[model samples]
Target chain A: MPWAIAAPNTPPPPTWGIFTPGTVGQFFFVIVYSAVIYWLISRAKAGMPVPEIRKIAGLDAFDEAVGRATEMGRPVHFTPGFYAFSSHTLAAFSILAHVASLCARYDTRLIVTTLNATNHPVLEEIVRQAYLEVGKPDSFNREDVRYLSGYQFAYTAGVVGIFHREKVAANFMMGWFLGEALVIAEAGALAGAIQIAGCPAVVQLPYLVASCDYALIGDELYAASAYLSKDPVMVGTLIAVDWFKMFITGLIVIGVVFANLGSKAFMNFITK
Target chain B: MRRQLPVWLGFIAGMLVIIARYFAFPGFTQVQKTLDNWAMYSGAAAFLMGMINLTIVHKTNIQRRRENWGASLVLLIAMFGYFIYGLFTGPDDKLFVSIFNATISPLGSAMFSLLAFYMLSAAYRAFRMKTLEATILLAAGLIGILGNAPIGAAISPWIPSARNWMTEILNTAAMRAVTIGTALGAYAAMVRILLGIERSYLGGRGD
Candidate 1:
């Protein structure tokens, strides 16, 4: 009975208690990456030329979609999907501002739907400001910036209803999404609305690609703010990100090599 | 001041969070908890604002007798009715739970069930033999379907192995690449925001 008892195993104590346990590698990456990004940003701030961003067809279609909506005399519909103050939603806000300005300049109605109540106020402010910036403050309608529902499917139903009722000429789906991605995109397709969808959600990308006229795949959604604004600092940050991606690719290759050689040393080092 | 205040506040909070993540500083956990609680409280307050917005929008529709005014009225009634009832009964009340389970749950499921038809239509549109990429996608999709079905194994052993390789190797590798790219992009965006460079979220271009 005494032999049946097991010894307790615990992690080793932290050295110097400076960094969080098991996060040394992460901290190293953060410092190096931030340093690289800041260096590029400073260069951009000093008016040095940075590498140009490649063309994203989905983003390029923004003006065309807005123009189509204007010519058709129909409202442009946009949803930032269901998220609360995420990076995806922030990117969505930039896109929303661009779309809102286009709508204001064209004197076309823009309808925005939000699943999260928290985003409603910010979205309304963004839309209102966009209109104001474009010298069409009077065209900003508070009612059009709607908070649909917190429930996923309910939001989908509401968006689908709007698509049919308002006869939306163009639909833009941006931000984080779930199962509702395809339903909304397909509903827009059924409504004959030219659709543009973007999200970092991998599982939902195929649906957007198949159903929407154009889709921003993966990091393209993150590239949106820089792509739309064409700000040098943002562009510089994107280039830094590309370099970091290369760094990660290198790590992946090394990890693969170690794995094939039957060694867990690299894996443990990474997890450290 | 109106604009600069938010950016400064954002920078402070973002730095604090980053520090807390990387270092084991005293009181950091408590500060993080407080920040989370503040976020929840802010969300609650925003819910009230959203309620007001809904009422205003729908009330206007009903007052002006717009198209689908009846639907608007119905929506307002249902929303307020359930809200008031929940307020009185509490969320854990048996009747409240039962009502939610009976109506909202089933409705959500029904809405989700519509995805099957949507997927079919989307697949049909995407699988058209128009381009090389489309042809590859169509062929892969057919193989994937066959591999999943029992009849596929009866036809050929290679079909299942091919499907497994496609999903396990090709699909997973692509997914990992996308996931990594997304993480890097998000981190970069966060850096820009924290450094007070990207002010697009504050209704301004990066100035």
Candidate 2:
């Protein structure tokens, strides 16, 4: 009686010791999505043309930011926001790799301040490798990749201090940010640093966009690694994602239309 | 091996979670639960790493007598002193709680208060009538500000209605679109990681 009341008007899912019945749709979607990605990856590997991702202004500014620091003989500052290991941080790492390489090539100083300690060692290694890749391994300073306070506002204070003390030429703030977003970016702006910022946090997006010279909005932060790397595999994966978005859009449209026609069939299929 | 090991582990763990989520397989729930616990444990372990790093970095600053070395010394004293005190008295102890409330809480709040000033500065720069979009943004910002204040309703009934429409309809729609796009982007990123294509997290170049 309790089970019936809890799941009123719903029959039990038929299971054959395999896929969960209700999850069949999601499972199939994942398989199709993965297959599409893999196929695109293979095509990219074979040098086949894929849809070129549009140029992102924030990513395009990376080299320019590093070069400005070099020309001005000032250091460039970067932080991957206040989060620990997450997709956003991973994307930030890709940007850092490119920035480090550019700094190495130009012999400009790059100072990385990390809020998450676990990300510190990884960031250090990326900077070191980037310098090595650019044939300037000796120029790499481990001390420059600093692990600042883990507390959100404390990290912001540290970044603000760096901006004021070092008088950085360029500042890059990428990854997940929260209330502290404007504090750091505005500090950079006040210090006369050219700033580029990206964050997936919607609430903080306005602050970053308003303060930073260039801001990567929404998924742009995720797209950054692929955009900057210009690697075939990465680019291919991005294209596949776009295709899947179109598919989802189509489903949404269909569901809307069916609902308008007084049919719950499509809606039930999706909700199932 | 240093690089490859992490990639394999990530792939394995990712697949396990995916299967456990979508498949009616037995024992996978237990596996997922175990992995989640491991993740929690590692995160706690990483905090200790953060402490060690903080000490080393600040110690160097003090040794070199770097600019603001005094601040570093104070930070170290505060950090370790508070830590040791907490260890002995426990976080629930009145003294420990009082110290946190006295120092860290107030300091954090003070830093957060700076955001209002920063926001004003940012808004000043952003609201400049340099472009059409900026002009629209300025209009929207004014509306949003007015909508939140008591005087806005006094100005005109329509002003509040317009602000409500903008916030409820326009802002919500835009935020939802961004949220959708971000979800897809994150999914793509995860796919890359699972496939061993996105290796930047391994402290190397992405494939």
Candidate 3:
């Protein structure tokens, strides 16, 4: 029925109140999963022990990169990648805040570039506050936080120009990078900058890995922020997500086993 | 209140959209259209944010007489010139289209074309058999690269089959893992934001 086309004059189907009838199972699943995560997070906030998150090498290199920038008397370059209000952008901002704070502490010049038009204003404020928090409010320069270009390739070109011109000692690229990841990263490599890149963009992961000195793969991009900030709430969310992933993996294996045995009940319930 | 208001609004609007998907009521379509329009208008208005920041940044550079500040001046002039031209002649005018096609389009393509050379350099470094993992990765990559190229078929028939197997089986499995991990991470991040647990966007002082 979902696939079938209705007659031109036919009346539309009736609604199933506020929740879709077929998706009730999905809604329930989400709610249950959320509840579990919420409970774990609450427990974590209460100072209960949660499983330790893996030590992400790329995240660990952030402080080293910042230190290197400080020692070399060169600026640190950061980009949140091309994003317009996405989860990846949010993750990127957390790292930006962390990096900016470190730069402020080290009295190192920090240059943050954004390709997304909307992110530019918010990013400026974020870097400003980060400097303020580190007691170096006067160090935040407006010129350094540039909104290069809204277009992806133009942004890449602009970033490449910066790497060549400014001669940044350490470059941190964390966000929703895509095809231009390599172009910018390769420029960083050529400039002899300690390049650390992270993105959940799997298609571009290989490129980042190839070009960057350190690459955060898969969920590491999301987890890196928590690792850097060491915020209880962020850490709690990270831990909860790992457990949920394991739960989903279990479900997937069970589903596959049942499916192989010609049992379509689980699939039917989800689809229905 | 700075963070709370926006967070509350986002949560309410997101819930409305989610709820709207279930019910095909008489007025649901109109509500969806209204919400979509508001989002579109907001996104369009964001271009102004970019313009203001661009002006501020370049203006500072020019004031300080920073290195290559001339480029910033040129950018400002070019941007305003284009804006004035579009304002008077309309954006759809032949001149406007001609300028965009001649300059902007080609410049964009030029930047994109540079990616090929960058890719070669990156691949050259990555494909080096420096470590066990690197060697295995280089092997897999070689299979993928050669299988797609015409020369692979000329070299050996099995090369193409091996490439297809590596991509269709091994690559697909790895891709799925990454996809699922990213989906979960993104979903969890959104949930945290909606619940007001994540407030980095607000530049809040954490407890």
Clash counts per candidate, in order, are 0, 0, 0
Candidate 1: list runs displaced more than 4 Å. Answer: A1-12, B204-207
> What value does the lDDT take at residue A1 in candidate 3?
75
- Over A199-263, each residue of candidate 1 has an lDDT whose tens digit, in order, gives 89999988899999999988888888887888898899999888988999999899999999999
Query: Which ranges in model 2 have alpha carbons more than 4 Å from their true place?
Result: A1-22
TM-score (C-alpha) between model 2 and the true structure = 0.93
- Encode model 3's per-residue lDDT on B85-180: one tens digit a residue: 999999789999899889878888898888899999998998899999889988888888889999999999999999999888988888888888
Local accuracy of candidate 2 as per-residue lDDT tens digits, A1-272: 65565545764564545776677777777789889988998999999998877788988988888888899999999899878778888888888888888888899999999888778888888999988877778999888998888788888888899899999999999899888889999999999999999899888898888999999988888888888778887899989778877888898789889989999998667555
My TM-score estimates for the predictions, one after another, are 0.96, 0.93, 0.92
Best by TM-score: 1
lDDT of 2 by residue, B52-144 (tens): 878988899999999999998998999999899989988799988988788777889999999889899999999998999999999999988
Please write out the lDDT profile of model 3 over residues A1-272, one tens digit for every residue. Answer: 79898768854444355554576666777777778768877887898887778788898888899999999999999999887777788888877888888898999999999888778877888889888888878998987888887788878888999999999999999888877888899999999999999888888998999889999887887776666667676677787678877877898898899899999998887655
| Pairs in clash, predicted candidate 2 | none
Weakest lDDT window of 10 consecutive positions for candidate 3 chain A? A11-20
Tens digit of per-residue lDDT, candidate 1, span B83-192:
99999989999988998899889999999999999999999999999999889999999999999999889899888999999999999999999998998888888888
